[model samples]
Target: MSKIKQFFVRNKKKILIGLGVFLGLLLVAFAIFFLNRERLLQYAVKKVVQKVENRYPADLQIGKAQFKGLATVLVTDISFVPENQPKLLQIDTVEATVSVRSLFLGRLVFKQFDVANGDVTAFKQDSVDNFSFLYKKKATGEEEKTKDAKEKSNYGTILNRLIETAFENVPDGVNFRNLGVIFQNNGRTISMRLPTLTVEDGQIQGRMAITTDSITNTMYVNGVIDPDEYLLAAKMYAEKAGGIQVPYIQQKFGATMRFDTLSLSITDKVFKNDQLTITGESSAHGLVLNHPKIADEDVFVKNGALKYVITLGNHYYSLDTLSEVRVNKAVFYPQLTYETRPNRKIGVKIDSPNIPANDLFESMPPGLFDTFQGMRANGSFKYHMDFYVDMAKVDSLTFNSDLDGQNLEITQFGEQDLRKINREFEHTVYENGKPTRTFLVGPSNPNFTPYNQISNYLKNAILTAEDPRFFTHKGFHEGAFRHSLITNIKEGSFVRGGSTVAMQLVKNVYLTRKKTITRKVEEALIVWLIENLNLSTKQRMYEVYLNIIEWGPNIYGVKEGAQFYFSKRPSELTLEESMFMASIVPKPKQYRTYFNQYGELRAYPRYFFNLISGNMLKRGLISPSEHASVSSYVNLNGRAGNFIMAKPDTTQIMDTLQLAPIDLLDF
Candidate 1:
């Protein structure tokens, strides 16, 4: 061996001892770091909360943390304060048992989360509230910028990933005790006492009790929920509580309604990326209602209970369509479905037998049922409403009703009273209540003309178009009323009045123009009075009706209608011109749109002209021979036979240059 090699071999043991000391010092440093990990975590969590406060609508305060070992931690005094609210949530302490294996694997996993003594408050003051944080719409450009920042931010991603993994991995226990919630809305306060809440494995269980105005109830929610949703799964059970009274709905109609029971159960689970696929069954009972104003009206729903299932996916929820709601012996089913994808479709259906009209009408405003107050509505009815859309394009909508009120009798206003109101015509008239806006309607007015002064063809057309049974019936025409109601219900809007001449006269002369329940009721009562009390002669009523009716914009009465559409005497209007005039009476203002720039009738007006003409022929208002002549030459002649006039609609000829005289029948 060389001398250099021999000298190094002797000192090798000393060099090894120096390296061992260095490694031991490094181990001691590591032990110190492990022991103080909880403090470091606490600082980190506080800093993160401060950073999040800038983006979140609420404020968060983290508490001091202490570690039992490397994995177990106890945090004290945590709180959340919403914007404009101080301390919306307060937590006294939280002890968390964690997974050591997950820590070694660089994953945060909670074995258990035990929360003790916490209070949460939710208040909605107008549009601002404690829970509003969930609904806060981020300012423009903020969300996009945040997403971009998150993608590039490493520290933020690490912190969030760790926190999310702690809950997402299905914590062994999610339990709470003495957690309370206080809610206030619209000048009313509601308190809910949550006694015990527990979630273990896949089971969710909770119990709560509440007491409020007109309601005192205890609710229990027990179900199995998705385990991965450790944070939100517990709250699903809270949704079952019901039987709360709404002051607005009650006061608006002067009625009190009880919900009985409404318990929402969420079942099924889709934990992928925290998506929820909730479906469950629930039961409801009671639902009694009463109105103080309506005489002896009470909806005593005896053991009225209902059971239904609900499902939620995407962003919307729907109740089972086949579920039946029972009230006493009557069984009624209500169905509602809403979905949005490439399109939106909503469907609603309700059907029942012998649903007392009074039971429904009592809790509702009197205006909607004023006309039927004295009549008994018997039989069955079905209501259907639906709207559809596809590929972001609108589709045809359908809303229809089938009301069968069999054997209805309005004994109060019978034919006896009807014959009496058909007698007074020599003077002015006004609606009984609305004395303001006095409509001076007398023959002395240029547009005022008696039935005798009107053209025979016009009279025939009026009777045929408005009421075929006008001469025979009293004030009510059930067939017309039924058809009008069906049409209005189906369209989901009011387009025509199922009113008789007497009803129309009463509405125009006596009631306010505003459409309301009160006005409608008044109109019904007055129409009954006009017909039953012999308020006016039928001929006189028809004459006054022609004088006061709105024919077009700024055009009132058939006299103005005559001169406005055809600058000629009302007696000189030909069959074609009169039919044209009648076609526009229902929607005169909109009918004006029918006249294009060329002073020619539009398609709808032209169609109505032909249809009414055909109807007039069918009714024998004009002889078949006369109808042929009227139909041949009159393609809606604009004003003059020559189609002549210097300016647009300066003057109009009656389209009656050479008309064959028809057989005139006197009333």
Candidate 2:
């Protein structure tokens, strides 16, 4: 040990000198790197431009790029132009400071970013667009073959990564001046200009001016963000006194939406146990919406808010039951889940627990519930709904909904009185938003038929064809509604409506014929009021329904319809004649389609007759003898027969009728 120490001491000087030389060389190399940092940055920029140009159908150019400070980069005259297309992106100058530690880890984390002047414009003419290439994928043959074999996506992981990446890209400080984004398609253009936008110390302030064709609007935005905690709160409002009008929707979709103050916030985002949960809140005040299909006038809401908790798992996404939705003073809880594995399924549940009747009435949107505007009510109502559907087994779908009122009563009426149907009143028929005819719906009218005067066969047939359980149920037939929902889902379109006799009666008596959600909802409210309050007896309501519903073109009520088709009074109509009248209720204007040029019933109508007759027989509404007495053909001897006879005989009668078996539950 002593000899080794002596030898080490003798070489210590030489070792120290060698170590100093190595350190000096390392310092010299770092100095050289620092000196050529600008060149290195430019080369890196060139490489990135080459890569982008090679991968996309675009050319990226940067006139100059250099290092301004230790971790700051300055770029000027950057442009990205697609081949044979307009320039997609252009920037006059940009300066960004990146995290030096992140740079060593091969990641560019911006600490501060500034843009002096820039513009991004997407243009489309015919079938080509300049910006679509950003989302276009250049998949190889191998990738295409392996795509189906790829493992199922982990929604939790994906969402977590998305949130992380988004927050990572948010710089601590940002300053943008004179930035514009424009989108032009065909002849329409939508442009937004940001004169100035700044974010400092987690606070954001910005001003945006939007132009759609000839209309322009300005908005002010203010927000606060916490990057490390994934928290954000933002609000947007108009520069003027009213709400901010959303641009382009009115021109493109024929819809208008405006909001006085829109606020959004993300309170928390947590990832644990292979799941991601996010909580947020959104609120709007003085919201206005308008569309031809939604309503004739603008729908206005005073205040609305939603507090939501969303969760993402491996094969499912869910909105937790903790979510609460509030409109004015009314509040409800909603839960929704969608699964992608083990047979795709969707489930939804909503619960509103006994809110005040007055609050509920006041919560209704203005234009939508005009009939309930000034309505005063007492007591409270609770609602619950649970719906689930498996795409693979839609036939086994489950749907249940209930609205229970606790001694609910109306003290005052709105624009339209609810109790008018109890007495004789003038009923008007509207076609295409115009009143075509008006008639008295009582014994005073010559053609008006009393409930008892109408043949039982006619009433039974109409009930069977329209709503089999109308007399037994309050206002809604759950089975028929379920059938309608199933059919609509299978068809992927709205081809059926589950309207009961009472609903139809309410619609005919108190609502317009125009098909709108507002009108349908109003019809439902009226039906509920009438049924629950016993304002009109079941027989009286059915009587009014038969007296007001259209059965054929220019034909109204059972008396007119029976005479128009069979030249007989309602009480004198035969079973076959009643079935014929029932069949034409859905499409009164196209009744001729059910008959041939010879005025004989078509094969489908014959099957419909048998179906209705069979249902009536099962319900004991008609005896076996009466069911067997139904004729296989309909004889139209009134004005309708003349129209059918005028058509040329081009349809060939089928020898063997083949139709899908109708669901017994549908009736």
Candidate 3:
């Protein structure tokens, strides 16, 4: 033991001396680095400028760059200009403080940042733009190799990294003065001027003046942002009393949106177990929206809020079922997921359990349910829906929806009486939003045919071609809706609508011809009330539908349609004629396209005849012999024959069978 101790004591001095020498060298190196730090920074900046200029068609310049303190940098006269384009960016002065500790850890973390007198402009003329280069990636001939790599990419990791980087770069304090962002495309220009914007002690305040074309608006924003905690809250409101109007949308996208106040907050963001979860809330008061495709009039929502929990995984993103949406007084929980691995799939689920009937009714946005105004109802209803679709097997999609009302009753009718269809009522036929004609839907009008006056063949054909389960179902056909959803998604457009006869009847009798989401929702609600409440008998509703539906140009009821095409009364129509009439119900304005120039039926209508006849035969609505006897040939003996072409043109034949033939089938 004594020998070992003596050996250790002899070697300890040399070991200590070597450690001291190494420490001294490290200190000397750090001292040299600090002494030439300014030069190193300048070199780095020069290299960055050179790299950027070489990579993009842009030029970057800096008049001066120097360090104010150990961790503070000040730069002057910074500008970026693209080739053959206007000045893209300009800055008079910029100052920022970095965290020395973070720098040692190889991270650039900001403490304080300030910018003065800067302008960022994006201009586009014809097909050229000034700012697109920022997002353009140079082709490396490896994109094809990486095309299938997206399925294996970890979304949660990427998103977490982005969030961390963004938060790290957000300074604890910021001051921006006289900053302007301008956008110009062709002849249109939009400018936003921020005279003063500041963030101090996690609180933010900003005032912006926006100008689009000749209109100017002022908006105020106040928020709290905690970068360290990944929390942010903001409120945006207009300077004036009314809602704030967003610029560029109305002119560029033909849509207008206004909101009285918009509030947004991110409560938390966390990454764990290869999954990222983010929670946030957004609310809007007095929101108004208008688009020709959405509605004719502006749709108004008094109050709406959404509390969302979003999740991201390796190959999927989801809105968790914990997310809740509040519209006026009603609340609903919604869940949605989109996956890309194995096969692309989408799943959506919504649940609103046992909500008050009045709350639901009152929650309907204004201008969407104008007829439902002043309506009072009793009892509550629960709505649930689950939909799943795998892109590889869309035909095997799963969809189920239910809106069950418990002892529901409408005690008071709204603007329109629910039971009016059972009696004589004035029904107006509109063409292009203008009232073309008005007629009585009951016994008072000479052309009005009762249920019995219409031939059973015509009724059966219309039912088979329009809504096969119209009599059995309450108001909606889930299978048809599922099919419609699938078809629309496949086509990437609204090529088919799964409207039942009841919906069509409501639309024609009480609603205008304008096609809009609002109209459709209102139509569905009305159909539900009429059918579920027994306000109108099935026979009466069918009669009304037959009396008011448009069959051809300027042709309004079954009587006019039968006479216009066949010069026969509704009760005198044959099975073949009824099928022809049913075929034209979808595109009445294009009925002439169904015939060749010789006024004979084209080949497309034959598919409809066979489909409808086959369905009828399968349902025993028609005998096998009767179905075999049915023919696709039809003769236009009425005024419709005058519109036929003088020569045969196969190209003019309308592909009506392509327009949802499965929907037309009774099955």
lDDT score, candidate 1:
0.56
Which residue pairs clash within candidate 2?
Answer: none
Candidates ranked, most accurate by TM-score first = 2, 3, 1
Among all candidates shown, the one with the greatest lDDT: 3
* lDDT (10s digit) by residue, model 2, range 196-266: 99989999999988888677778888999999889989998886555488767887788998888889999
Candidate 2 deviant stretches above 4 angstroms: 1-90, 94-114, 120-162, 182-190, 212-215, 241-243, 248-254, 271-277, 311-318, 339-344, 597-599, 633-639, 646-667
Worst 10 residues of 1 by lDDT: 656-665
Decide which is better by lDDT, 1 or 3. 3
lDDT, each prediction: 0.56, 0.82, 0.83
Q: Give the TM-score of candidate 1.
A: 0.43
Predicted structure 3: clash tally: 0
Supply candidate 1's per-residue lDDT for 477: 63
- Measured with C-alpha atoms, the lDDT of residue 62 in candidate 1 is 69
Ranking by lDDT: 3, 2, 1
Alpha carbon lDDT at 452, candidate 3: 85
Estimate the TM-score for candidate 2.
Answer: 0.79
lDDT of 1 at 344: 62
lDDT of 1 by residue, 1-667 (tens): 9988887799889878989999999889668768756555665566657665876778888667677665677878988887777568898988888664444444445788888898887788797677645423345597866754443323223323443554455567778888888788866777777788777876778777765554545656565645344323222222333344434446468777655454444333333332233334444344445564432244444345454544444433455665666644445667666666535666666666555543433333223334333443333323333333232333234444344333333345321233322443332333333433334566445556778988877776766666656666676665565455444445557655666666677766644455554455456555644554455667777777777777665567777777766786789899877877665555565544555456566555555555556767777676778766754223333332233222343333222111101111121
